[model samples]
Target: MTRIDSLRAGDPPRIGGYELAGRIGEGGQGSVFLATAPSGDQVAIKLLGSALTGGDDDPGPGFARESEILRRVAPFCTAQVIESGLLEDRPYIVSEYIDGPTLQQVVEGEGPLEGARLRRLAVGTLTALTAIHRAGVVHRDFKPSNVLLGRDGPRVIDFGIARALDAVATGSGVVGTPPYMAPEQLEGAQVEPPADLFAWGSTMVFAATGRPPFGMDSLPAIVNRILHRDPDLGLLRGDLRDLVAECLSKDAARRPTAGEALMRLLGARDRPVGFLLSAGSAAASGSPAPPHIPDSGDAPALSPGASRPPPGAGARSRARRRAAILGAGVTVALASGALVHALTRDGAPARPEATGPARPLPEVTSVPPPATTELRLPGLGTTLHENPGDTARMVSFMYDSKGGSNHYARVRGTNRFEAVAPWQEPLPSPDGTWLALLPWLKESTPQPYDFVRLVHVPSGREYIVRLTDKPLQNFNPAWSPDGTRLLLTTFDLSSGSRTPVGFAIVDAAAAKATLVRADTSGAPAAAPFAWSPGEPAVALPFGAGPRAGLRFFDLNGRTLRTADGVGEAAASESPFAPAGKRFATGCPGAFASVCVWDTATGRALARFRVPAQSAFIGWYNDAHVLLTDKSADPHKVVVMDMKGEVLRVLAEIPREEPGENRGTFLFHYMRWS
Candidate 1:
């Protein structure tokens, strides 16, 4: 039976006259729900989200195109589309429900399928593709998760990005998943039936072996292999292996069509209904028992260039037109905060003038709580053993092991530690209500894809902020003080080496992004460090090569100010002070000092030289700066006053041995609201 998650707060109770039962699943474009029809039969409802179509009320041509494409495709081995309409402005489709786990889930739980089962899946999915292509529609996105193993047989689902054959030649950017995408899709070329065939081949590899044919590590490596190298088929053997290899050919023109591949698998033109699929050698092969017979429909030759005039709608270009549909709602929610704040606050002590010779530098102190192995936060309260739970303020600390360096989050004020997502680093928002997941920060190069995923800490609801219309690896994400916006540095790596593209300012609440292309001709490119607390600008270290000092950039890519004599502060949560009056950075050249600069004047205000190997860790408050003591074992997070005196220690954490090639081990904190 297919598992359905309870509906979230934002999910609609009903759509197009059907009462939604619960959520079946969610994907990049939208969420799918199990629904009850008026006739008492159960159906599946899909509400397109993200940038799929126009405003909820409009249901633009893009939505119309999707509905028409879904309606035209034959339902022999695919989910049959029942109806599609606009409900409360969002366009949704109703389709027949398939009660079973996805191919991905099944294979992951029970390992690879054997002879008859694998062969049936291939034939069934290919039949669906043949019918779809014959109907003048292309299943642009086909992969393992899209294949549902129904009790009747395997059904191909989710035509969210499908296009009528006539619209395939438009200027569509990369649209499918990286691993299963063909070379043509990666290069943004015209997609035809061969692309789906390529995906089918890749999905087969996943079913035979629990991984994509092209290794699924970094996006750049996967894309490069898809375009240049041959696929690793693993244990896939015999005639199917050769078929998949041909289907995965780099040259799309060389791949076999759905009907041709189907014929080759069946080893005949067309088998009769209920014909023994596992006869002779197939029975002797010791594979699983023969599954239900699929539609032995005639393998009609599906032409790669088949086409017909599309009905009253455009292709993905219409999606671009509706990109800002959700922008209005987000803008209204984030309109409260002021862009810039005054550096000084009322009742705050003013910085004393540099009068007598500097007093003796205060000795750094390390204070451990009752437990040496656990770090504690005063106001964090009791600990809860869950991920990003409400009322749970968690701090993530890194530890090194034989496998590698990974992060584990400890509930603030308690000794319990919890695991978040694996392989990705989670940076919590300022308010601890959201978490941004990205590739490990140690790697200079990012995975390089389209968007940044921000997960709401309390509800675990996820929102995706696309960096640009096209693919660019975005990195160095820093949350704004209010946690409503995020700043990221973008890079273009299609040509191999990472090249400075620009910066992207993302409105986390709005799911909208604006790309600002800065001048990269003068100084070497630098990652953005922090957002200005008072204004719509960001801090980036520009004191390198031909340029000197730390550069401040406004949202429009214009330089606001450049403070000389200081560089980027390593390990700093943020470079800006809470009051937006002063910023912190490392003194230019060496571990000599930490400098504080006036935000308004871009002038150095004070310099503090104390403990060795100590790095800046943002402002402890408006008047004091936080620093990490890493010169010795059992590192400590300490606070320092404006008078170059170490006031006290915040937390003392046990230091773990750094793994081979794993960079510095550090701790990060997120305060719960």
Candidate 2:
């Protein structure tokens, strides 16, 4: 049954002296009722379904197994199992009621969490997993629905299907949801803790993308995909990709243990080392701030009057403080001296000298440019403007079609044509190193599009990256700044309607693809619009309505700032200048204007208009701008200097008859070399 179908409503009157107030949830094995005890505290009473408890034809021990596992693990993780007894000829177990919605509900309603919230969720979930694993139990069903975001943190629930590590006969009849189940589970192999790791990977995917990795409609198909298919990890950010990759490794031994996973979730590799070094420095400097050694128990309290010392005390007081600090420093040094002495020990670099009084953060202002220019492309029947700082040597390829065939041709010296290829759909890499081609009949019977070939410009070597068996129609293949990843938006026609499902990021080096997010109505996914130069975060464009704009997000899907509407309002490739201080965008149509926007604030700084309609914009050096305009007879190429003054008329092509317009003139796709 589907998840929604399993849920039961209404109260069951009474069960084992507890009054059932309402029905909370249900699953294939049992039904959970919201009930109250004599003390008025709430509890969830799970009653085994008739199918599992045993029908008239047979008697089974499903409830017995659940009770045993719950009793064993109650002390370590999950709600306290208050009692278990027979009610209405069926065994039921009551657990402490947890007040919160499931992780699945949260993601479905609010998309994904970011920044501190995402980290905290990961830590809490891993901690729960660690507790369960230490109790010698494996929670076979660990989907998002089973994880509740409690008032304090996340609490892992639904251990009803949990099994002992050594148990041989647990009556495994394909337990757990197929999308979240591990490959081994699909193979009906003996389950282990690694299975939970696989589940955690799926859970994390759901948390990040608001959906499972595999997009299957049926249970059987999902099961098949999980057994043989590799999960798409394109959308995951930062260290999450590597961590999730390790957790979902095919081999159980390769998967990290629950404890190791927890440490990774807590960023132990970065945190513990930094904490130790800072604590050491504080003690050596004679600071009263005690070393913070994080433990698995309650935090230690500071003694009364043990407040922080003033920043600049007198020399005599400083000497006394240093003596006290030296004593405390020696104590810590002796205790940790035997520990692994690594780079952070005596070899640590000395802190740099502080500069003159600290300066305030710079304010970002969106300054409009002084002027704008319009460009025209006669061959491609389009007009665009050149962005600032672009060199005149760069070229742009525009889509051109004639005689029922699609091709891309660059505008050469003046109004000349230089044919690159015979593909109608073309997506160029940011650095112009590679080109992604899509060849499909615009109007034809629907078919699955399977492969994307990436061709290196210089060597002409092609690599086919296959995403799925279904026919694929996609556009906008943008390369990440490093050129290691390619992001493409896909359109799936299998559902009869055009569903702009989502985008996938393909690791160019590995030739593997992973789905990042799904958009039902063809809206753009929250993919990074612009990658930070030599940094991990990308300027992501998102939000709804007029408030929708751009913000910076780190690789781990963490929002660095909600600086929406912070740049020129234009669509597609907002190529930043060399200094990254400015960017340019094209405004289409008759009064085609190119506007330069200041990156700091969302303001139109400058605007320059051309004689014809404009389509694309590119910068040529710091002074001249190349524009494609379609208004002048014999469409013209207009060149403008940085101050918006007309520098030169690069070229002009005579207009051709409607039918002959295909071959008379060619437009160059402009790019900076």
**Residues 1-673, candidate 1, lDDT per residue (tens digit)?**
8999999997888887899899999877678999999999999988866355423335545566766767877675788788877665556778989888999999999998765467667777887887777777678889989999886567888754445212222343567888999999899888888999999999999999999999889999999999999899998876678999999999889998887786455332222211111122111122222221223231211113322111221111222322221111111000011111101001112222322222222332222122223334322222222222211123554432223334455433345555544334456656544556554321211111245556544444455454542234555566776766777666543333334556777665555566776654433332344576678776565545223456677777677776665664433225666567777665555353566677788676767665654545555445665555555555555666656677655555444443332232334544333
Scored against the true structure, residue 63 in model 1 reaches a CA lDDT of 62
Residue range with the least summed lDDT across 10 consecutive positions in model 2: 333-342
Give the residue spans of candidate 1 off by over 4 A: 1-373, 376-394, 397-415, 441-448, 469-471, 494-500, 520-526, 545-547, 565-573, 589-591, 642-666, 671-673
Model 1 poorest 10 in a row by lDDT: 329-338
What digit string (tens of lDDT, one per residue) describes model 2 on residues 1-673? 1122222444368898898777778677668888889899888888865455334222224445545666655332256567776665556778877777888888888888654356556656776677677667788899988887765456687664434211223243777888888889888888788999988988888787777876548987787667667777646776666888888777878998877776444323322111112122211122122222222331212123222211221111322322222212001000000000000001111222212221111332232233244455433444444334323322334332232222343322233334333322344444444545443222210112234555544344455455432323344455564455765544443333334444456665555655433223213331224443346544544554335455554544345665444333233433444345555543222124555556556455555554334323344333344554454455445556544556655544444454422331222233312
The backbone clash count of each candidate, in order, is 7, 45
Alpha-carbon RMSD of each model? 24.3, 22.6
Q: Scored by CA lDDT, what does every candidate get? A: 0.58, 0.49
How much RMSD separates candidate 1 from the native structure? 24.3
- Model 2 gets an lDDT of 0.49
Per TM-score, the best of the predicted structures is 1
